[model samples]
Target: MSALQALRTVSGKLQKTQIQVSTGLRVATASDNAAYWSIATTMRSDRRAISAANDALGVGAAKVDTAYAAMSSVVEVLSDFKAKLVAAREKGIDLDKIQNELDQLKSQVLSISQSASFNGQNWLNTDVEDIYDPDNNKSSVVGGFTRNADGTVVVNSIDYSMLQSALFNSTGGGMLQADPRDLKTIGGLRFDYGNGLMSTYSLRNTGGWGPTDFNFDFSSPITFGAGDSISFDVTADQDNPADGITPPYDAGQTTSIVIDAARVNSALGRTDGTIGTYKEYAAVLRSALVGSGLTATTYTRFEPPGQTQTWVDVPDVVGIVHNGLASKDGSSMAISNVSFNGVTQANQIAPRAVAYGTRNSEMTLDFEPFTVYADVVVSMRLRVDGSYSNLSFDKDFADLALGKDNGKVETSAEMATLLTALVNRPDVIAQASGSGTVSLKTDPLVDRKSGEKSMIGIDGISVNIEPVPTMNFLDVDVARNPEMIDGYINYIETAMGRVVSGAAALGSLQSRIELQSNFAKHAMDMIDKGVGRLVDADMEEASARLNALQTQQQLALQGLQIANSQPQPLLSLFQ
Candidate 1:
């Protein structure tokens, strides 16, 4: 090659090396190496974006931590409230003071919810209107990065909603809120026995009887003269004289209604019959009277000779006033009204006698709008020797129709007594349906604005009441009645469970947030390392390259000087 051409080539190589040493990069701009610079720039941008996303994740984690902390405080407060409730159940303890303490603890929960906020995001204290919105309630945090072929970048994130659960929610499942109560029927009717004696007997007890079971307490005993006989008959007889009187009488039993005067006179005069005279006839007749499942009693009143003596002949009466039933088999006869076959006995006034359930024979009667059951009760008492029998009883109300004022009792005494008798009555059957009012139960912690049951959520932790109270817990009078303390204790225990569950929920959420936070940090470090591999300068390689380039520059300068000297020698030859 010629001297000038060679010199130009070496000078170009020297300029390139000098630039590389000064810049410390092989591809500083697109012009340097378009493909390499482009790759490095894009990769650098990705790293920055990833770092920014990680920063956002950090902020979100802070907010979650704050919520979790608030929930922990709420758990403490609820625990204290439960303790106070337990204390309130103690005898002679002041409930009002205990309630005051509970109220304070409740207030603490509210305060925690209100203050549980981060970066102006208050999840705990949010209202129903705000949290009900799907978009508003849901929170998203930066999670990961993705690049598409379309040159678009995507940032993935995690999302979750802050709301109350079964244990704690502000709207329906929270510690401070009440649960809804369903409509229900009232329980069994209780008898108001006058002397504080209450009993509920099932009409199914065919063998059982009440205090006064259709007894004929005669004022005076009848004296049977010659050719005189009394007939005893039962309207619906199941059996004749049998080996034993079987109750719930089956079919095919013989019944009789005849009276023999000759037999009666013969028995009155016989010593075997225990009746030598007419005065002792009634007592002997009771035993001699024969009928299936038939029972009798005869007693004499203290009176002078020649004066008629009193006697009592009736069915056996037994059983408590208000027992539910003899058996739960659900088959029992209902008594509506009683019929008397003869003159009334002692205290056998029409209204009072029916009210006291001392009537002779009862039967099943139908009635409308019955307060107890559909079928009315019918009972009876027989006075064979009396001149005549008169019956007076309101079939529909029976004994319940005493001192009626608009079909209701007017006098308290009569009302109480009548109610007592009705409660004590044996033949009155207990039916599932009746003309009774239904009681709608409700909880005490209902929302003030809507009066609907709602729960309260604090810091993502929820506590709630379940199997909602039939009555307001605050209104429960456990202090007055010692028997009610057990219920109150149960309520407190349930509340404690709610609080504990809430705390556990918060703990789980906190762990998730922590793991995500850690992942975000790790991802940032990995991204930084990747970007460094693409664009960051290698100082060791750059330093070595700089020294080599400097030596090449010196050699190029010396070569150019030598080429100029050769041109000078050529000029000498021309001289």
Candidate 2:
């Protein structure tokens, strides 16, 4: 019975060794080793999940690669487009041909963006109505898989903003189609009296004019008919007790000048008694001043329209003229005691006494750096020597005058240059110094006695602010609007920067995905090794055990047979 029991134990041991060798697991079921079996099973499932995540990472990497390729192409195309725009700025180039090339480049950009897709996923081209929609304008790619200590499994992904990568969208918010820099008004006009007092006037409304001696409404043409005349008294070298200079009270000379058709015709060297144009009328008035003993070099200087070199030809300067004449020889002048015959009030040519040389009318503008996003419009109406000159600075004017890529005055020096170009008048001098302060004044007149320099006034100035319209790279038509080439170049340069940035983002994502894929593969291997340690059987050990158990089984069987024979003999003896 002992031999039989030993034979049964050896048989069971051999069967277990055979199962271990066949299945290659030390704990194949819960009955073998419940703790090890459970742990190994869980590890094997985690390895499978990691393998699946690695596969997903491959797909995500491919999508990122496609987007990167497309973005790189777009960057190249935009560079070429900007080069063409720069070439178009040349004086005699054929803008139409350049525009055709630009069109082709723009079309290529669209083609690349639309065609760059992987598995129906496109990052450069989008169709959402608003690209700024937070929820819809983002994309994610599977990056990694994680199993927490608490036994919870989670899948991780890499996220990217579609807004940054989108080059073309059916809606209007694409990077290439939107405005990069915001329109901003940097500086405005203000009266600086060289004293501590300064004042700013509204640009939109004309009611801000402070105390004035005379207000003339020349908004329309004046018809000087026969026998019509206007007269005003002019005084020179007037003595004042408040002038701070020793004075013997020398009586200044006063003269009256009559402006009529007879005088105008006499000034024009014609007997027709008629002035054909407004320019001719202005010339007649200037000549009358010179003929009335006021020196042409000192008193006849007047401000012209900002757009022209002379005051007589511009219509916009005809409204609400202001006077700012000064003497160059320390002699004061005044116009007063006005009388008009046959001149209606509709002409608004009323005259009043004004003490010249008492105050300076020059203005200074302090400009801040342009850092906002909006269009800026500066409207100014300056009065010099009793005349009006209207000037406005907008994108159109800036482009025409400066021909800069951004079409904006970014610095005080740039503003001065733009103003100088826009005014185009020799008498008006605009200068920038000490950071961003722009001093606008007429050419200085030297005082013959005291050697004091006197600058005529630049008054009635205002500024207007407005937003610049969005300029799209695709809509660049230099052939039709040749003036907009600067703006086009600016927009294209900004768009190219955005495309390059998006491409860089994609490249970074590609590298991350590759790293994650490698990590997933390594993690899977490590998990396999761990599970193998828990449940995988050593083949050599299992085979050796099987052989040993078989040998023991044979020995026990033989011993059991011998014992049985002996038992039979003992039983016979007992009978």
Candidate 3:
């Protein structure tokens, strides 16, 4: 072998060994720095993680900003609603036209309310809703809110599928009862007794309300002899026996009388000079006496020996005046005294009587809130989503009726209710419909003709007055208003104002969040750059270092060679 070849081989081996030790790696080529390469590769991975997290946070901020912006639009819409409601109170204004404008504005408000969204996550569009109140640490429906049964976290989450199933009554088994109640009816006339109505008898001339009346007739026939008088029962006749302001003038004199049974067969046709329907009965007795010739003269008035409030003897004269006429019985009519022209028909006057029911002093009827279910989804989270036609209600306005003009909250809750019913109502509302207005009701006006209206909501949430469901605007009811309509009217306006205010607040919050998100993104970028400077190797700098390491290694090789030569000289001396 050539000496040069041996030297070249040994030098190659040393160079290879130096490369491993200098680089501190098994492989010297770029691929040989496995550990260093591994570190760089891991650093790149960590950088990516930071970048990803930054981008995700940025997106979250953007979502929050979008939600806030939507709320701003909502505020404007709410303002419009308030203004319109307030205008409705103008005395001489065209209420119908004003209401039309109000309806349009309300629709816009609802659009804003429901259309709010943020990064597909809706802040206002809560589903299993909840409200936090530090005061009570609890929420109540009295304020017109719906929340989870346990009331922990706000159920402000809604799934796409849940929103999708909204073309009809998809809640529980509501579809089974979806048909309108207008289809129900009752035939013929009906009577209603307020609190009390007399039956068969009413004291205050209630007989005028006729079913019928009970009556009896009496007949009397009699003739008077010299110094004689008589009285009798005219049970089968047509004569008012007793009905008088002043007595002693005619047979139909007294309105009340007692029968003089002893005088039933009186021979004469007179008594103290007062005649009654019994006069006819007296005529009968006199006729009999005359026919028998036993003294048509048997008609006689006699005075017992010493009677003071005395009966006077009848005179031959045809007319006379006296007293002690008749008396009355507690209940039944008893026939007695009479002054007869002859036997003719006479009727007996009977008192009118009736039974009464117990009276009721006061009564209160409660009208409650209603629920509405439809398949109209609103996109109020972001402007991009707010324009959607898929609007719906959160099951709070089901069966509101006419005359139930109850008030509502000024928050998104009001918006939700109005949107669900007014936005897509099949009749007076718009949109594709569900078991909404047609299936449910929240109107407060009755079709005076149809006379059919929802009495109340299934939830028992009452209305102050029923909305008059119409092709245009609904009628307003201000029943027994303590505020005399003004306060109520103001309340409506205030509600609208509240809605606007809330929207504005939400918008402000969104703006802040968006700004902060952008700032955060920029800050994160700067931080990552700084981190990279901290521990990651620079490719160019590393390459330069490698060159320096190579030079040092060559010098070390020369030093070793010199040291070996010195050892060889020592060996020569020994020789």
Which is the leading candidate under TM-score?
A: 2
**Backbone collision count in every prediction?**
50, 8, 91
Q: Cα miss at 331, model 3 (Å)?
A: 46
Higher lDDT: candidate 1 or 2? 2
True lDDT of residue 24, candidate 1? 55
How far out, in Å, is residue 445 in model 2? 44
For model 2, which pairs clash?
182-373, 182-374, 183-373, 183-374, 183-375, 184-374, 218-318, 323-386
Query: How do the residues 1-575 of candidate 1 rate in per-residue lDDT, one tens digit apiece?
Result: 36556556656755655565576566677886787678878877776777777778788778777777887787677667667767776778887677667667766777787788899876566544333235745666676676889988788887766544222344442343443211111021111212111111122100212223233333443333444444433221212112122344333222233223445446455423222333343334344444322333433344454566744433222111111121111111112232333322232212112111111121211112222221222232211111112222222453445544223222334333343344342322222122332111111122111001111110111112113333333333433544555565565555556556655765676677677667767766776666456545566776676576667666766776787677787798989
The sequence of per-residue lDDT tens digits that candidate 3 reaches over residues 346-419 is 44222323211111111111112232223211121101101213332222332241112332222233333453
The alpha-carbon lDDT assigned to residue 161 of candidate 1 equals: 61
**What TM-score does each of the candidates earn?**
0.47, 0.54, 0.31
> Each model's C-alpha lDDT?
0.43, 0.65, 0.33
Residue 430 displacement (Å), model 1: 26
Q: What are the RMSD figures for all models against the true structure?
A: 19.0, 18.3, 23.8
* Candidate 2 least-lDDT 10 residues: 203-212
Q: Pick the candidate with the highest lDDT.
A: 2
